[model samples]
Each structure stands twice: as C-alpha cells, then as structure tokens.
Target: MRFLCILVVLFVGLKAFSQDSVSVPSIDTTQHTKDTLTIIGVGDIMMGTNFPEDKLPPNDGDFLLKDVESVLKSADVTFGNLEGTLLDSGGIPKKCNDPKVCYAFRTPARYVKNLINAGFDMMSLANNHAGDMGDEGRKSSMATLESAGIVHAGQMSQKTAIFEKEGIRYGLAAFAPNSNCVPLNDLQGAVQIVKELADTCDIVIVSFHGGAEGAQYQNVPRTNEIFHGENRGDVYKFSHTLIDAGADIIFGHGPHVTRAVEVYNNRFIAYSLGNFCTYRGISVNGVNGLAPIIKVFTDKQGNFFKAEITPTYQTYATGVRIDMQKQVIKKIQELTKKDFPESKTQIDDNGLITYLAQ
Candidate 1:
C-alpha cells in the first residue's frame, strides 16, 4: 500500500509539471522585432533656372524643398525625381523655346550639398533634364550626387542601387521607358535587372518618369505620352510591369501633375507625384498649384504594411510657401477622392497636412 501511494504522488507531480511547461509562451522573437522600414517619396524636384531672372544659386533651389525636410528625414528612406542636371559647366540647350522644347535645368556644382541637407536619400536622373547640358552634364550630375553620398539610379550602367537597412536589403531602379526617360528598347533589360534584384534583396522599389503632360483624356488612363516623336513614358503600364517582376513599390513622375494611385498585385503605385517643389515653373502651377507626397510602411521582410498620401499645394505665381487655403485643400481632397474614395485630405489651422487616410 505504501509503495502504491508513493507512485501515485510521483505521477501526479510529473503531470502537473508537464502541464505547466505546455502553458509557457513560445520564445520566438519575430513578434518583438523593432524593424519597421518607412519610405517617403516626392515628385519632380526641379533645380534649375529658366532664365537670368529666374536663376538662383544651386543653394537657393535647395530652400524650395526645405519646408518638408523634417518630414522626409523622419522616414527610413526618402527619394525624389531630380528634374535637371547638376552641371554648371555647360551652356543652355539650343532646343529651348522650340514650342516642343520646354526648359533647360543646370544647377551649379556648389549647390550639391544643399541636396544632401534637404534629406534626399535617393534621386532619379533619368528625366529629360538629365541630359540638358548633354552627356557631360549628365556625367557631372552623377559625380556630384555620388560625392554627396546620395544614391542615384536611372542611368545606363548604374540603373539600380542596393541599400541595406536593418537586416533588409532594398534594391532601387529608375527608368524612363522612352527618349531620354528610358529608351523603349531597354524596357526588357530594366525588367530583367529588377527581377534579379528582387531575388537577392528583401524589397525592390522602382521609379519611372513617364506619363503624358497636362490634364488630358489620355492622361486619365495609360498612353504612350510621347512628344515630338520622343518617348517620355507610359506611367500606367510601366508601373504594372515593374510590380509584376517583384517590385514592392513603384514611384512615377514627369507628368508635372499628380495622377491616380492604384493598388495592384498587393503593391502601391503612385502614378505621378506631380510637382513637389519647383521655383521657375508657371505652367505646372494650375488649379491648386501642385500637391503630391506618398508614404509607405514596411516590415523587416519588406512586406508593405500600410500607406497614405499627404496632399500639399504650392501657391501659384508666388512660388514660395504652400497654399494653406481651405479651398485648395478641399479641392485636392475632391480630386484624390475620385480614385481613393477612402482617402481624406485634411489641413490644420496652420495649413499643414494634419491627417490623411487610404
């Protein structure tokens, strides 16, 4: 009897211990990982003077984007479309004022530091202004951006950049798809490169300077927005291709106007960020001037978590200060609502983007 009682007590104690062990939580640390990546992107950052009167030192142009410096730097990464070349050695292009010829953008080398100060993590030099002063100017822009430690993409050889943050590797590529923008012949090559990068990196971000200029019917959908036999780009199709090839985010610009944002294949594509900050451009400032900004959040594995757009309006003609007028904010809200009905654009009393959704 004594032996049987002792055996029962031991069995009971063992069972209780087993139950307690099972109740303990799993020790996996993935849930506690503090690695959340954020990328903030803006639109055409024109850094050139239209003429002698419109000319400002490269440093002067830097002030144009200074207003959003804090907001940009707050993100893990920030990027924009560098609208012009950064070479001061070249003369203006002869094609200026050809009706088809638009503007010449050549920033002085001295102002390169301002680009860094403005919180630009990356800049795309694949726009029309890239070769404004010709290939020499393009070369100079490349060297200048590199000297400032700014990652640049959209060139023939260095078409993509790889960045490692936390434990995640990010690959960024930019293309134009026609003319100086991307050269349609290189479309397949661009896609191949992005795919390869996607295989190695945790996330892939693609940028393109495409889409038709002005508010036209064709601009609503996707069309080959070529001008004077030159191919600028087709924003809609360009984005779709990149995403299909494993891109996590697609940033589009060069239309000088904000287009629609669509979620395709579980990815977010900003068709056109419009004009983020440009001084010397009047045609771009119609309606509510230019309001554009996109925010993205991702996890350690580079999976997108959430996104939102902060609409901003630059005052027309004045060229300084964001238009904080209530009517202007409401107008952007109405425009964005056309595509993202869940999106709401609200401005605070001081004229800042207080809240945004969808």
Candidate 2:
C-alpha cells in the first residue's frame, strides 16, 4: 500500500511540474526577427513623345523598359520621376516663344500600362515638364496614374501620397521649383509636411526635382543652383533638412546627370539619378547618358542596411539598357568622394554600398 501511495504522489508531482512548464510562456523569437524592406528609385522617365508621332519610339512603347523591367520588379517599391504628362490628345501645348530651346513631352494615356508592366509603384510629378500642357494635362496624368493604381505626389495641392504594402505604411512627398507642384524654396513648409508624413506612416520618402541641368551639373553644389536664370533649390540643404525632419530616403533628380550618394543621419540620399529613359527631345551623351537604378534596404524603422546601384545607359532615341561596365556606379563613387569626403557610405567597383562604423 505504502509503495503504491508513493508512486501516485510522484506521478502527481511530475504531472503538476509538466503543466507548470507548459503554462509558462515560451520566448517568441519570431517577433524579434528583423523586418526589412527594399526600395528602388530611378530618375526621369519619359517613355515616348506624343506631340509628334515621329517622336514616338519604334515599338509603340512596348520595348521601352524591357531591359530593366525585371530589376525594377524585384523590389518592395519601385519609383521614378514621371517627367511628362500622360494625355492621349486634345490639350493645348505650352506656348514657347523660342522654338529652339523649348521642349514638351506628352505620353499617351495607353502607355500607363507599360509603366505598370515595368513594376512602378510610385512616381514624382514635380518636374518642369509636368505643366507642359497646363492643368488639363496634369489632370489627365493624375487620372491615368490613379486608374493604374500607382501612387503619385508633387502637386502643390497634393503634397503627400500615402501607401501600404506588406502591412507597412509609406509616405512620399516630392518638391520642385516649378509651378503647380510643391515648392522647393519653401524649406519650412516642406519640412513640416515631411514631419506630418513621418508621424502618420512607418516610412517617409522625400523626392525633389531641383539643381542645375546638363553634364556640367554632375556635381552637387552646396548652395542654391541656378540654371537658365531659375533658382533651383539648394539641394544639399534641402536633403539634409528633410532627413532631420524624419525622412528615411531622399531621391533627387532634374539635373540630367548622376550625382553623389550620401548617408546623412543614417538615411540614404541620391542627389541625382540622371535621365533613366528619355525617348526624345533630351540629350543622351557623355555623363548625361548614365542612368542609375538605386536599390536600398532598410529595417522596419527605416534604418539603412545597405544599397546597390545597377548602372544603365540611354542613347539617343533608345530606352534604358543595363551598362556592363558599371559606369554610373563608378561616376557616383567619384562624385561622392569629391562632394562628401567624410561620408560614411562606401561604394565598391561592383556597385555594392555599405556604411562604416560610426
């Protein structure tokens, strides 16, 4: 009897201990795993010109982005500066007194599908060309992008575009010196908008189409740049201020050439991506031809982890093609070194980017 009672007590004690162990919460390692996201950005993209049929590309815009489509698709978000309006027809063109200097770009509304196929999730409509055809053109462009489910921002009235992917919310705001878009000169206003976006979303991306134009403008000037008597924003000041205002990434374009990449306060900034795919009415020579697609990886809170630059080139009347020599990466490296000698970001010959220990 005594032996049987002892066995029962031992079994009861073991059972209680097993229940207690099971009731204790197990460490949830899954919740602690790092969450990351990838964002890719490119510069000006005008698939084809619609003002004159002859200006359009050969394949009805079919092959415009074929070469870089897959690379663009491989990101959580792909963005570009939609340098022109999307209108099928019927809008009065902007009056330009100088026929030699004035150029306008209008892409057919049907070509929006090509952008979708290219895997573009967002765009900036703040370039000088956005108003080439007036408010009607801008309205048509906005409608077309909306129908295609692509998020866009840059208009003065609509300064921010918020989107969500994979349960993460992202906010984007674009600034430019042109009319009908968020003014790049209003630094205080721009910072306020960015701060509001940062408060509302998990990540905030600030884009600006500022700085001088052409190959001579390859270097980032610390002061306000003036091209053709227009005051392009002080890009160095603008980018750093936006980062201070809580922007995770800053993508700058409008200078028709690639510029330096800097890490300011642990955020990534590409001063200029150059002309990615401008089919007509744009120069594509020397440094102007260099196109870069920058891919950035960041943690859930938008801390930069690493980056990669896939160099591309665009010749006259041709779309963007991958550069085997990685010329754009090399150019960026040189400019980064010259413009920001104390930068923590490192760019290798192979286009890989890393940060040094603080």
Off by over 4 Å in 2: 1-34, 97-99, 316-318
Residue 180 of model 2: what lDDT?
83
**True-structure lDDT of candidate 1:** 0.62
* Pairs that clash in candidate 2: none
Error of 1 at 75 (Å): 0.5
TM-score of each: 0.76, 0.89
Worst 10 residues of 2 by lDDT: 19-28
lDDT of 2 by residue, 65-153 (tens): 88899999999889999988899887878877676767888888888988999999888988898988888889899779867878778
Tell me, by TM-score, which candidate is best.
2
Candidate 1 ranges with C-alpha deviation above 4 Å:
1-33, 50-54, 57-59, 91-100, 178-181, 184-186, 217-219, 281-284, 315-358
What does each candidate score in C-alpha RMSD?
A: 14.7, 13.7
TM-score computed on alpha carbons, candidate 2: 0.89
